[model samples]
Target: MPVTDVITDPENLTLTIHADFAAPVERVWAAYSDPRQLERFWGPPGWPATFTAFDHTVGGLAQYRLTGPRGEKSSGRWEFTRIEAPTLFEVLDSFVDDAGQPMEGFPAMRMTLEFSPTAEGTRMVGTSHFDSAEALEQVVAMGVIEGTKMAMSQLDTVLQDLRAYAQGKGTRLELLDDTHVRITRLVEGPRELVWRAHNEPELIRQWMLGPDGWEMTECVAAVAVGDTYRNSWAPVGDTPGQAFGFEGEALIIDAPRRAVTTERMQGTDGPTTLNDLNLYEEDGATLVTVLIEYPDLATRDMILATGMVDGMEASFRRLEAAVLV
Candidate 1:
């Protein structure tokens, strides 16, 4: 699990939370931008939230209710004051009555959410400024800290499903054969943009590496039927001149649509694998499907045992973030 840190400053009357996700900044931002996704994880465990009104632009208003296990309910309203897509937003949040009016004698907080790129993925920093120390303490006594942590912890699964649904897969994995594994997902970008991210060496270097602290030191892409490409990566603290990577040949190339490659792993005496990559536009987004064929069932099973699926998922999530830029 990624580290989640919460800090409260009595002098400043602020509560700040710092959390990391193995996803791109844009995807993380979607949790707030998309009301349906927001409602899915906005409240703590056992207190599911429902959004009655949501407007994402500046000066918009959002109203929601959280129902407790014992049939009790709490309502809140957020008045948005700032809008910055995939990066930052600011809102004034306050308790609301059943009729959607602000409740008197309750605390209101000015909240700011900031997303930034990090070596591993995206780091979200959220700060809530209360009018007084008493207000901050009031919220803390209401389990705001623990509730927020529980809500944020649910993001990993949300992101996984989001990526899959965006690609039209809906959390399903397709297996073609004993020696082949196919991954199909919706990339939230244009077909050309998604293709460029996959075919261009620089763009590939930006997101293809599995996680943070790893750099693709060398990247070369020749997008032709008979052309070849090579990519190499090194960990941040590794000694200079020590790197591991792969080189592959482009067996088939159909620009911005489909391509096939024969890949060989570096520093290993393993059988070469064939990769078939296809991209298409569907319902205003790009659908990307990748088929990886190993030499045999044993080889495929061995690779799967190394936890490559998780690494691929992380890489694809980063790719989703990259093309949005």
Candidate 2:
């Protein structure tokens, strides 16, 4: 579901796919470099892949076999043509015989993988180039597009596990009172950097995004007492006039220590909620505590039922990577 676009261009003999992950570029790159991680999501659903041999350096080779549900197996190999750490790589992908030889008359494609940091998270752009339009169409007819989509969808689970491992522990959520909720996490970074990432508009846009395919289109923060902060977000692709955002006013601002704000959701007449953010350095890392006070218990329950906790956990994981790593 994180895959936003899949384009097949016959004129250029290329098949391109765009996927977004709620993790840093380094983590995303590791999913490809590490054979154990690569085997987790390298094949389509119901067809798990096992890597027989893997060497991730330039001119190196990788061999894998995907086993279908009905005891069927398909072998493949990748000849690494180029390697650029944490950003880009190129490979010659082809079908191989049981003896590890390239299959004759099968269409071999050149693949380029690109990883870049975006406003929300890391964007992976994969382009596969065939020798000719006929060859490209041949692969497309063989269900390559759908297979790729299903395979990439599995990355979300892999990324989530990687994030939890990197953060040391999962986020903690508690109901403080009938109308209050508290969330806390130990982030791997300095207090000042964590504070800057939350207060600065430019840094906020990079990690505050709630989910994949959504971006903060507008962010204006006035980080002083009585100043107002306004932000907006919408889908990143092709959907116009559909937006959800909020505006808030600063009530208390203590740089690198604490901040209090009153936030009102856009297009809603509900009572404004109070948000308190406190930061501290503990054992060379930062501890971020957020307390939310709703107008009533119903409002708090509604927010909790909306899965905001999961979304916030995803956002904070990105924040940890952007600020510290």
Candidate 3:
């Protein structure tokens, strides 16, 4: 199966982030304690941020920008409720403008981040709590559910790099899933190289379809099936992009190996896809292949008519260079 990004069951509203930084508690604390330093690595990979006030003392608050609501665009903030330095930091985060006006009825969601010293470095956990069931459901419908995943996805990378910097050596994160989907490399490349390419922007954009007068602008995955897949892609001018890109949860994901899964979205209807990736090694050569299975006979026909095969080919070529080199 493929990797997914969010919890869509309405019942599964708690968003969590549990990770370890391969650095001492002091080092990890330093990264978060300094507002100047914290902004350097907040939110997801592409979304840069700016902080207003950051006091890492007890009962201090931290405010920053991640984005605006309604694409009102630019700047988001978090108002702190509790702060305990190297140990914990809590706040209410939302898509508020610089003026601190929150989005409609969405209240300031409370989040708590905890830091504990580990044998190697620091162990961290991020958890958010909504004020009410109604508010939680409302935000989920408003796309914040997936938006949060994108934010987390970006943070995962930042911490990973920070760990490498602290340890002076790279560490690997292996996520493999079990499902009918298959993953493989049609082109020859080492597994390590291909993995890195998946994280590269230039390479991702090459086959991301943003240029076909369309794009896969926002790809947020929750890492499991029945979670959430939110894609927000818009046309540069008047290209009239196809609906809201792609959305849905991952059926399965097999990391450091092959994976298979499908993603669905708003306009895609019952748009379900079954993907498969197969990986094999021969004399240090890695071969990977990605196959997708559409739901129902009608969807299969629809995909073929949309030149999906060509799109897949283009995507693989881009992946080859992005990952292989």
Cα lDDT of all candidates, in order? 0.78, 0.82, 0.54
User: Which candidate's lDDT is highest?
Assistant: 2
lDDT of 1 by residue, 1-325 (tens): 3437899999999999999988899888987788867765787544557799998879899999986533468999999999888899999999999999999888999999999999878999999999888999999998898888877765665666544445444323555568867666677788888888888887998788876667888898968878888888887875443467888788766677667788888766667887777675655676676768788999888877866667677777888776566
Task: Give me the overall lDDT of model 3.
Answer: 0.54
The collision pairs in model 1 are 119-212, 166-186, 167-185, 167-186
Report the Cα lDDT for residue 81, model 2: 99
TM-score of 2: 0.51
Worst 10-residue lDDT window for candidate 1 reads 163-172
Q: Using Cα atoms with residue i matched to residue i, what is each candidate's TM-score against the true structure?
A: 0.51, 0.51, 0.42
Candidate 3 per-residue C-alpha lDDT over 15-126 given as tens digits, one digit per residue, 9 for 90 to 100 = 6656666667766777777775565446432233557776555455566765221112355566667877668888777766558667665466777888888786677777
Better of 2 and 3 by lDDT: 2
lDDT of 1: 0.78
